[model samples]
Target: MCRLMVYLGDPIVVADLVTRPSHSVMKQSFAARERLTGGPGYIPLSINADGCGIGWYAREVERKDGDVTPGIYTSISPAWNDVNLERITPKIVSPLIFAHVRAAMVGTPVVQMKCHPFSIGRYMWMHNGEIGGFSALRLPLLNALRPEVAQKCPCFESDTAVAFAVFLNQLDDPMVQLAPTALAPLMAATIATIRHVAVQNGRGDETSMLNFVVSDGRTVVAARYTNATDEPASLHYATGSAFRRKKEASADFRLEYHDKRSRLGLVASEPLTDEVADWAQVPPNHMVVLMHSEGSFVDTLVLPIDCESPEVQDHVTRCFRALDQSIADNAPQALQQAPGGIPRALKRPSFATGEDVPVATAPETIFEETGQSVLSVAADGTRVFSGSPAGTIHVFDLQTGKLLHTLDDHSHAVFSLAVADGRLFSSSMRVVNEWDLTSPDGAARARPRLLSTRHHSDGDVLALAAAKGVVIGGPRDVSIHVEKACADGVTQNSEATVGEQKGELVRARALLTDALTGGHVSTVYAVVVRGRWLFSAAGDAAVKIWDLDAGKHKASLYGHAGAVMALADVQKQPSSGPDADAQKERSNGSDAATSPSDGQEERSDAPDGGFWLLSGGRDNSVRVWDTDTRECVRVLKGHADDVLALCGGFGGRFYSASADGTIRAWSTATWSCTQIFHHEDTVPLAIWPTERGVGSGAADGKVRSWLVDRK
Candidate 1:
């Protein structure tokens, strides 16, 4: 076992968190005061000074200034005398950080590659405690890794690294990449998979300390756990709104806990100071979640892992489903229909359009490895795309229900995506790449030949809307926060040029003022354009409608009590021709741009004959607003947690994805939730309306589609 520490909340200096405390992570390395004993006086190593490691999300500025990935330093030398660490620790600061000191189990080696904090892409993982009979467990666990991950994972003698490999296998599973909460079970199953293999290989008798931690550089998940009979190593956490040590430099600097009820959490192997009362010990079989609250403060959740629970079955089923060929054969078929068109085959008995049979929900087909932040469907219904937390984009073919391409183009997470004129627009902090979807397989690769790149120096392109010929970008950036904090000397150094660059980040936020109509007071999270009308949702808790052509604010529609996180626009339409020629045209062009008002009747919901805007919010409620009157017609409430995304005009229904990990489908007539798909396994962050059904992306850097099939 070893000493492990995880910090998730406001930014803090590595020197203070890992070095300055009275019993700091540095102290733990050479003088671990509480080493555990097996039995009969056989105490494990007292000094965890075999090696040390620190992993942190480098300043976005560091990356903005050309530093590519997060900083991860692992050394075979003890941290107490590591010259490089001493020089770097004081200068480095980050919101998310992990520092670990190692005391290798009996069979493991003391080497740099065997240090804590194993990382791949944006994911960083670490472990304390040993795997029972690790040598026996190692090969199988390593073999279980995803081929891509296996190839990339460095060869190391540490059992912790192998456990991380197993965890990586579960993590990179397309199904496991749904959401953050889904990670807990996937992690548990990874441990279970290891133990099952260990037992099968006849190595189950040894001790196993499986306390583990992992993060995607934003959301942090840590577990204090052990095998069936073993007691866990010490693990405690402290959380509050304010996490600070005194501003004054002192050798006895200890993290002070204030505002105990507020949102912020930190996990460590032991208490950082003598504030024993403020620290709470983690339960043996539970996982700790730490994520940013509304802003910088953290929201924490502790969940139990019951190995025999249905989670295991679901995880297993998903794994089998992926490996087996049966899924492609038994895949749910989409009864393709124009939006608002209810097919006659499954007509409700009470309000029958043609059939006398009772209506039932269609069979659910879950697509795996969906990106978390954004999901967008091509207007023609031929392609569906999702953006991942790992800076990847997954593209799927709607007809065959098969993955077409995985575009790993962005150096940061792809936050905004839009489809226009046979091209996909993907934007991150600064770079925007437009990919020509009509190109071949090689065209989906990073720096694809047909791809065009553009830079938005204004700010992060938080939302994107591409329609007809107008491309509107709604910007948001966290750089301003960094700049503001820098002014207060939060990250100040003696260097003057560094301070000026931080100021540039704030000025960058003001650069895109030309596009702002009446100036959104907060980060713009959504953007949609219909004809000359543009709809956007910002942190101001209001949906602003602007006239794109006039470049002026029309009205600010207020309804959502919390920040409006998602928005979808559906134009009222009358029944269209069922002829083959009409269907062909519908598949070739964006159905969203077609104006039925030219000849067809407007849907009853839009009495004034205009488009309807459906918006979802952090309040866990969705409000349907009529653009003509700028009034909310209905408030849909079915999700138990914050609604992160909304999708509408999919086969006469609307869909919303929530933080509680579910998708609720709404009826067009009543604006009521007709079906709730409990994908509670993953936090669904993005949802998109598709001609066949719906597509969703979760926090775990995966994307999937749900195809509805008639009974």
Candidate 2:
């Protein structure tokens, strides 16, 4: 009837997995290889294009202490043409992800809200089969629901929603406590209750098909069940270290064993690829328990849902005359093993007892540094660069934080430093300079050579982005400079574009202003380039995307409450410019050695190998936007002050620095903050992400470093 999948692993970028595969979810949307009904005369709709959705734990950074619910993005757009899906999916990295492509049931209207992965509180659910005689049993079930839940979902037409409502009612407590073995019997009771109503309406077991999955961040309980047919629904599972290209499966991937214990679990209505041996079919009328702490396995006890028969009814009552008792008997140890709904909120004060307020907790500080400018880690990650307002560029050993050199030349604040082509480049008010850097040879410290000084803009340089030998630096104005390639007579609002002028050092010209005019209303705070797409953020609280070749603004997204602080593009295989010894480092300065490729299962990489943009703002929030749809999909919040910088790698883990003097480490798993780096002066002017750690430049003019290890 529909295609539904649940992936529980380390944060994985899903675009490549869902869209890029040969027989990807996109192909399944139109040319499904598996279905319940489809032949010549009765050629039913095999394509599931009705609608689709994705729900994922936005990231582990934003969860300080509140709910563990994920952010949902649904659209009526078909998966093949969902531009947002293409742009945003690559950007999203999650440990727990729920995705579904829908094929509207007979008599049902296709609506976005009606899409699968329906959610409530911290739980998310999706169903693959239909409710037998749903219409006849709808009112009876709604009428039977608790006033609170029913009142909210009264007219929620969908049978799936109704079933969830029934499940909620079975919980009884506002703050519900649950265990792995507790869900099956409550489900049995709900089905029994439905069966009772069905019999009252003269309907029987032959009318139902129910395969459902429910996840609450911490755990997942999935069941393949039905009373109507011997074949409840096609459900299969695969477990692995991470979802990677199965060498045996047509380049598409499936769950793979990363290790004996650190297994990644996946469940789907149909196998996404051709690796038949890797997938295990779930037995009809049985359930599977997937625990975050205990890998994945099946739940044995089958339920007695066919209560319409006299023998079944007698058996149900003989065990426990009441339905609650029947539900209780399934998990006798639940009363003690189940968690108390939410800890007493605020533990009783040592003396009296006051409500507890959740506060952001910081992580261990393995290293700390204080400096004046933002921090830049070399593409190789062996060096950290800092530019100071005193017109000096400071280079330090990334691992040990040892100062390597201090080149004082610019009289203005060293706002940005870019490393490319074996050299370090410094950008400031109106000027860009390149330098060659190396550890002090023998005794004398390495002095950076002033390769070429080109005035690319009249305004200050607040940000820099370099790709394919092009470095874009600007504030009120942004111009494109080709590494050391020099240019002459570049101005604003000029339609006359000069060809690349040859320079002495690098290949092409010195600088070239992009052809288009009128980029941003206020100061352009940041800019990033990927392929032909150009993204920029400004003080106008607006983020705009443009086509470099077309020279036009494609879409403008407005969300930040204050000025945009920083912008970054996180890609699977980060591309670096010409290999530079010192002065010519790629402006972005991503590390050379990638760690996700290592045996770290949680740092799994995406297959399609795409990129995403991360923007931090003065509003103290960071928004991840899908370049294709140009919509802000997720917002991460936790910093006490304005967010100044954002950086991460293939590990799908990122770090943020704030004016509150704290540097926080975040993982994509649950979008929760994993660690906090703190120090005396605290104001981290800039942050550089390392494969294994983070380097920071602070207000106190000292560089700090810290080692990060995620569990």
Candidate 3:
């Protein structure tokens, strides 16, 4: 029950799609001719007489010069009896390539690191189904990775190559430590951490088959899951086109389209040729992206799962009572004339009255695991620090979601999670530890100390923040250091050589010479620092405004069309006595970093501290923004797909996730969308909140725990 393929646009040759495709994947390993069986159809079968494994990669050039990177190769022989894969499949070439091909199924074994493009540096991975209960969740999911991803996972065993080393130890930036536009949250948290360890061993009703293919040789995410929502399997997708082969002798390749470089893309679980309109189909269980040069699509069922459908739970209880009456009818008539506040409109003007208070009932499902996802959620609101996708980090309690400590110390997935003071930070790619969790009991032999490690010679820690100390971010390392507070071990930090600060690096060479004199697109991704000001979000859709005590370059802002992911601030909580020293004597009587002229309107009786961001895109809508008026005020819409990940939290509240299996929350003073949640057959590649109220991580490898009660 497996077959996969993913080949990015242009630059070909990994044997032009695995040993000259005419049905290649090395001729479907001795004749697979595209398998997909299901009774009355799908007959062309062949597991290549039971032995065949291949995993190519190309894009070299490093014999010294500079930029070129990618070069991997894995083989268990049988790519038609490799003669060095027929002398290196027409001599390597790549834009981004991943070639799978194997046919072993049932418990599978064949060795050579269990083949299939599974690499770790410059990240390359491949998979094609069969994870139904993996030996009943293989020892609590291999005791949840992170002993260097269970000793670099691949005991010559095979659960699709130990589920890509449990997705490189549940990734927090490990495509060999990143690049390729941060690889779609590590291929959506490695297919939700192997469907949450095959539904914790019970095999969650069998039928698993997740077809995957990832790449860091420059972005390429390919997935085709199936937990059944109307039976999914036999995948097929071809974008724009271009496969060719049959001019006469026919082994079967033929697709070709082009239409003047709309660019080509292809994903397959079946259909290597016979272009029925250049091969469509891909709908079962979703996910298919070919980003950058565009040309590829797939993701739509329009959200709603977790077993509902009573008319989608009465349209999500009327979209949560129209978002609590649109924030109590958009309050903000000067906060209902100050005083003791409480005009009772339900605190809405983008929300600020005891924020995100839902809990009328339902919620108690303690740590269920099953294709887990919950990427981040560090809490102080009573202790909650999640992080999953199988690199593991559990630690619950939020008034009893129970399970206090799990921590498998990341091998891959667990992307960023922070929690000040009593400690608890986490990360994945180029490491980042630091846990103490003031533990009242929660203990997995509680150890985690390593205060610093940074590294990122090319990129890894994709995003993390702890304010007043550790920052981390990604895409070839975006800076923001400080950490020294609680300290523990791994303290490396020192690599600016190449002529140390060639003149404070001339402002990154004047921002790459203003991106070639004005074609800018920023690319930072996301960074946040509060007190000394630092806010970012790039891909050039613009949003910077740094100052980090003048490391230079401030003011950038611009708007967003896509790219920028998440950031938050929204003020009003800094009171600790003297009626908070009487609001710091009314903000030292006003004016602090001014800037509100243009037809004026900047009132703050000392409290608007400001900050709202939300972002999320590829255009499936989340929007928000308002950092003191850089605009974009509201957009919300009901996620049917794209939005990919976001957090915001506590009281001006926000959550999002998308590619649409749903995770929602919203309420920035009522841009609406109150609950939603769902998650059913998975898609959400990350969602957070730990001191307990939310935690989601999907792609179907399950890691759910929601208790958020504010009533």
Q: Which candidate should be chosen as best, given lDDT against the real structure?
A: 1
lDDT string for model 2 (1-711, tens) is 677788765556776457766666666788777667521322255678878888876444544475466678888877777889888887876667788888775566778778877777666778877777788888888888888988656237888888888877876653444654456566666666766777887776545767778776645566777775457778776553445664544556644321112235667777766655445566566555444321121111222333354422332222121112112222212112211121110112111112132223233232234444333333335666777655667766655666777777775556677675555667765566655544346323455556556554334556776655456665323334344232322212221234443432333333333212324433466777776667776544456665555544454455564456678766522332112344221111221111121122331212112655678866667776544334444577777556777777436677887656667776654455666676453467677776666767665566666667555
Task: Provide the RMSD of all predictions against the true structure, rounded to 1 decimal.
Answer: 22.9, 23.6, 25.5
The alpha-carbon lDDT assigned to residue 510 of candidate 1 equals: 25
Per-residue accuracy of model 3 over 1-711 as CA lDDT, tens digit each: 435577655455566567665675666765665465533322236654333444433433322453233455656766677788778767765545666666664445556666666666556677775676666666666678777777766552567667777767757545343433334445556667667666655567776677767666444666666676645556665543245565654556664321111234666666566444344554445455444421122111111112223432332232222222212211112211312222111121121123343422233454544334465556665545667634677666556555556778566445567777666667654456666554346753343444433333322344566664444343212333333333332233333232214232111111211221121122244566676655655433344554444443344443333444455453322331113223221111221112221223433311223556556654456655445544444556676555656776676556776654666676555456677665544455566654444566554444565655444
The per-residue C-alpha lDDT of model 3 at residue 24 equals 59
Ranking by lDDT: 1, 2, 3
lDDT of 1 by residue, 253-359 (tens): 43322111123467888767654544556667767666543323344544555444442233222322221211122110111111122211112212112322232
Q: For each candidate, how many residue pairs have backbone atoms clashing (under 3 Å)?
A: 8, 54, 46
Clashing pairs in 1: 174-369, 369-702, 369-703, 370-702, 370-703, 371-702, 371-703, 372-698
In model 1, which range of ten residues has the least summed lDDT? 326-335
What's the TM-score of each model vs. the native? Answer: 0.44, 0.41, 0.29
Global lDDT of each candidate: 0.58, 0.57, 0.49
Who wins the TM-score comparison?
1
Instruction: For model 2, state the Cα shift of residue 459 in Å.
Output: 64
TM-score, predicted candidate 1 vs. hidden true structure? 0.44
